[model samples]
Target: MVFDGLTETAVAGRPAWRHDASGVLFRRVPGGTYQMGLSDAEMAALSAHADASVMLDDAHRMRPIRTVTVEPFLMARHPLTVAQVRHWLPDYEDDYVDDDDAAAHLEDEWLDALLEALPFRLPSEAEWEYAARAGTTTLTWRGDEAPTEEQLLDRFGVEAEVAATENPFGLAAMGSLTERCADRYGIGYAEPAPADGPPVVRGGAADASPWQGCGEWLLALPASRGWQDMFTSIRPVI
Candidate 1:
């Protein structure tokens, strides 16, 4: 879980930064305008079922279609692990019953580190989708040749399971792992807080429930403040 020194690069003539932390290399993603949101097929899938429980509706967690614009920024290449977050805020407190609880407690420190390390903030629902898509127009980032349940299961090294095609960026688990997805307007995830709080994690995890990774959109519940976990522990984009 050791992090190497920061590596520097230039984007659009501006100095960009990247870091290798916890065996993942986070590279700065120069932001630009891109369409976001679910595809017709996805919408149809949600609408095909009239039962509110299985339908895709805003009240039921579906993001309404919309247009959005975003500024350039950086993001982590992968989900932040417990070991990674512990690097900076060794004393991160966990109030929940399990690792999920620990994730919630360390949120504040995570934000703090992110702010200190770069001139950016967490990707908005719109931003998250734009990046996850990595410039593609498909149900999931992977494309129409969606992975079969078997393929996805194989990737996870588990029993047979369904798989959503990844977008062009090689970002697996966007639809399967995380609910955050691009709509006609932009990217969005389930808001972590009911009133006000930091953003929640976007991608799904291996430890989540089977329903968590259903072909439907995936998103994590928000737990703590961004600064609580010393963002250093979370992944960072160059």
Candidate 2:
């Protein structure tokens, strides 16, 4: 199958697409309804397992575990890479990802051009969580198990290898990089979004560190919500 000039295929039951021009693979997320926030139990467990950078209060943003229904959509298997950006903007500069080794750091100014030139756009906050969960109700797509100290530390720094873990939906690196989303973030899910508040960002950057104020482990959770930053990247959806 082909959409937006990309070739699609089914790999091990999950559907995926390859943008030959940019070498970006997109995974198809099936439409369905699922709870979209952290449960009290999950919040407690995550706080216990995370470092001091994590604050119990921050979890309030993901509260009131509400059900969200999403239509099927295609999301980039990995965060947008520098190479993929260059494919659309040959003279692209700023933070770069070499040979798909890392996710590119971009600003919204670039998005204006890219969106006009390509068939991609940022995923919505709901779509992101749904895709990240990959049909799992656990704390992570991996499961509800508490992460060991070593496992939490592993997400602290960025490595050349992208998508270190693949979820059940065949999406890669869903949490490896903090990603830009299409929704504005509010104090809580029920609150109306503040006009000047930062837009919602999802996932943990592979190059995260403890000093960033938010624990890498916390940012990596599927239900975790974050705000945009200089290092925030994106995973395009269609």
Candidate 3:
């Protein structure tokens, strides 16, 4: 979604910059008070489906709704891509390799950029939920039910085939793309160690299962600090 020059200026201290590798652009998301968490319908849906999918057990189901406030920052219009990330840190060759070499190399660049951008770094678990919720109070952004196939495909592109529903901000395929929903505190392609496995990249030229794309869940991984085989998509907070 494109923003007006004035809105862009208000949100991002500077004008938006487009990355050379990926056409994906970013706009500043002005932080403000937003209701965070799932609505009653979403909770009911999760309760109804809990027995069918291990992923939806009560423990992991949507939590109580809460009011959250965020400061202004930049968020990528689309997820970060392999090509764009490489421009900043070229040492990463394998799309899924997260190791000491990759982390050490990319950390400096990532940290520098993040610090310069805003008082906030990446969205924490609560922050991501608040932003993804936009202004809604539902389980999946679209509603409790999964979105239609056509709707899913439109938002996620190739990854839509696996998306169960769209989030409040129209973010699709979040859960299925392991990379998108995995650990919330890692940088670049790295997944911290001791996770289920390396994080999977989200968005861009990949397929995920419909069940995996549910907005209420998070894709687990073995590591939290290194690269993964999947492609990366980003939503940067300016």
Model 1 per-residue lDDT tens digits across residues 1-238: 1224656554323343445443333434556776444545555544543432332443224343446577665554444434444554465454322452122223354445534654323455566666666766544444434233332311322112211322333333332233211122212333433433334444442223344335322222111011121222233343
Alpha carbon lDDT at 6, candidate 1: 51
Q: Against the correct fold, how does model 2 do in TM-score? A: 0.82
Q: Superposing all C-alpha atoms, what RMSD in Å does each candidate have to the true structure?
A: 9.0, 4.0, 9.6
User: What is the model-wide C-alpha lDDT for candidate 1?
Assistant: 0.39
Clashing pairs in 2: 158-206, 158-207
Please estimate how well model 3 matches the true structure, expressed as its whole-model Cα lDDT: 0.39
By the lDDT metric, which is better: model 1 or model 2? Answer: 2
Per-residue alpha-carbon lDDT of candidate 2 for residues 127-220, written as tens digits (9 for 90 to 100):
9999989988777777766433234322212532333456888777676577888888787788778878887988763546443434555667
Best by TM-score: 2
Ranking by TM-score: 2, 1, 3
TM-score of each: 0.51, 0.82, 0.50
